[model samples]
Target: MKMKTAVLMAAVLAGGAACFAAGAAELAKVENWPRWRGPQDNGSTEAGRYPVKWSGTENVLWKAELPGKGCSTPIVWEQRIYVTAPVAGQDALLAFDWAGKALWQTTVGAEKPGKHRNGSGCNPSPTTDGVSLFATFKSGNLAAFDFTGKVLWRTNLVEKYGRDTLYWDYGISPVLTEKFVVVTMMHQGESWLAAWDKRTGALGWKVARNYKTPVENDHSYATPIVVRQAGAEVLLVWGAEHVTAHAAATGEVLWSVGDFNPGGQKNWVAVSSPVLAADVLVVPYGRGARLHGVKLGGSGDVTATHRLWKREDTGTFVPTPAAYKGKVYLVRDRGEVECLDPVSGKTEWTGQLPKSGANYYSSPAIADGKVYAAREDGVVFVARVEGKFEVLSENNMGERVIAAPVPVGNRLLLRGERTLFCIAAQ
Candidate 1:
């Protein structure tokens, strides 16, 4: 199951360029979901006219049955949709046409089954820079591919840096910057943030990000968010009970904030990632019960200086909060939805969806002021978060969903347990 130094990527191609995909002139105007958090690195896509009501049979433009189980969210560039899945027990990346047809399938290597019931070997979503795309598996294998589904290069992190010590499966996806594709490893031991050359797969930089925390608190499933501050790229990482900012170019720790667990709580691993609302950074901690708001920028040890506001009553455990129009929208695991002012940490409004025994692991997404959320039992809900919180619709997909709902141009994409569905306004 080990990938050789010079990786072997075999792609089975189909329809080319996903024909009639992106209009040539409008291509520059189109808002493609290049990464998991979307084009803006937040869950909101202000350009799309997503479906407000949809079901397994209704409003579905096309539905493609997936070849294997995957929880990774699909990323779209133009009309080409890229997702990771295990095809015949091998870790592979699959491409689909805009018409919901398989474009190509490329095998990376053997799959690493998840330890959690809802986990998978393809938890990390694929990221693309329009020209080339990047994907990483739980096996620590990261590979890059061309838009035609040809493997450009491959590298195995676990093979180079040794195995991860996280309690559960790796959940962080690869993030693309101007010149590098960066990834992070946050665990009880040997935590680090590293970047590699986007074109040649060469090691660009690696920075140690280890921290001490209570037992099991060091294990983090949260994904790092990339943002720009002071006109330069910076990475906001949440893990090991600390929030740190790193120089995206040289992998240098510019500033750090800690003391998240003041009471020394144990087993409070970070799963829900940090989200940025304007210039304020919102972090969910206290195992989904507490939330924090911090002001962006400053030098080393901004723990006391950048601290803004915090909430002790409510937070989310699994679903990363989404920010739109400078407000934070959080869909708690148990169905409680809260919209807050990111700068002041003030609760603007709160609402709840239909009570379900199942929880929400998919991060909520916002499109044109509407919040799209998915429950584990396959029920997707749309809530309007403008003047007040209002439940718009609860559509059932008839399967499980752990990936975040993605709203691309003129359509909303939902990746179910065994299928990929595209919903459009009709």
Candidate 2:
């Protein structure tokens, strides 16, 4: 009788765990890059001694050839790496071990190829909580998988809700809290912030997040951020000419900050996501024309009260700013770099990379006092950004790269158009 019950449990675990709802015991550590924006959601990590000089062949620990091109950055936990890419003609999730060996591949739904030259069907990066992984695609496929590559649950948001009407590919990656995995949609019609059960894939709640703005300002490809305020978790979402906060559990609107476009600027769509530097949230808007700094806590409309400062002289359009050691760093779209004081929104120092005809699509990343910025044309520049800004070295990957550089535990992962290269001092 005991043996029969044990066998039944094993069979059920291999398929799905909705009834069990139990996950692995290991929690995410400081060395893990659990999500696309990195573990802290600011595109910087201090746990690794990253390489400042390396070529395609030098310091290349290992390279795993991906099945197809994906603009999403790879997330790492411990020795495992997870990435979302289209396999053959279907959207798929792939797993790889520490030694660049492919472990498994699981396909979820049909692929809807991207419209832009760098876009793809699997543009959103896969996120993990050190137990199960989650991914969303442009085709509206939302699926969860256990560590062993078993399909836990799957659904299509486009089929259930409606198709996305964004001008570019769907790029906002999913974010996770302790109890739920939340997704934000800020397109032209019926924008919302919805949460789903991390284990069962069930909808928990959805709250409307509509606002009035100029043309194309309603559409947002920026991911929502989880923050702590007054001993509770809040979601910081940016779109439609405002930055709003909502209760993570109930999806209730907490507060909002507006007046970003006083001139009613047209076609000033949001591309880069915001980053948190200590208590300040740095937002880049107006297609590289402006930057604003807002405080973290408030209720109702706090546009006038919570705003720290605003800058119109410099900002980024595609590359999100990276926060390191309480300072917000901007590797602007045209390779001009600026380090700002988050508290005052003042520029601390300024520098520039080698001027490139191609803009920067991959956001800058910092690890161990070094900065890594990649251009769309495949050249990556490393710089020392601590006291005096100094250019480190330039590396050419010889392929298009849109994914941000991920550094964790002495290894730097660069996802290019042809392969995923792991860099370390081996």
Candidate 1 C-alpha error for residue 51, in Å: 1.4
C-alpha-based local distance difference test score of model 1: 0.81
Candidate models: Cα lDDT each:
0.81, 0.82
Cα lDDT of model 2 by residue, 37-95, tens digit: 88788889877577877775688777888888778888987678899888998999999
What TM-scores do the predictions have?
0.93, 0.92
By summed lDDT, the worst window of 10 consecutive residues in model 1 runs over: 6-15
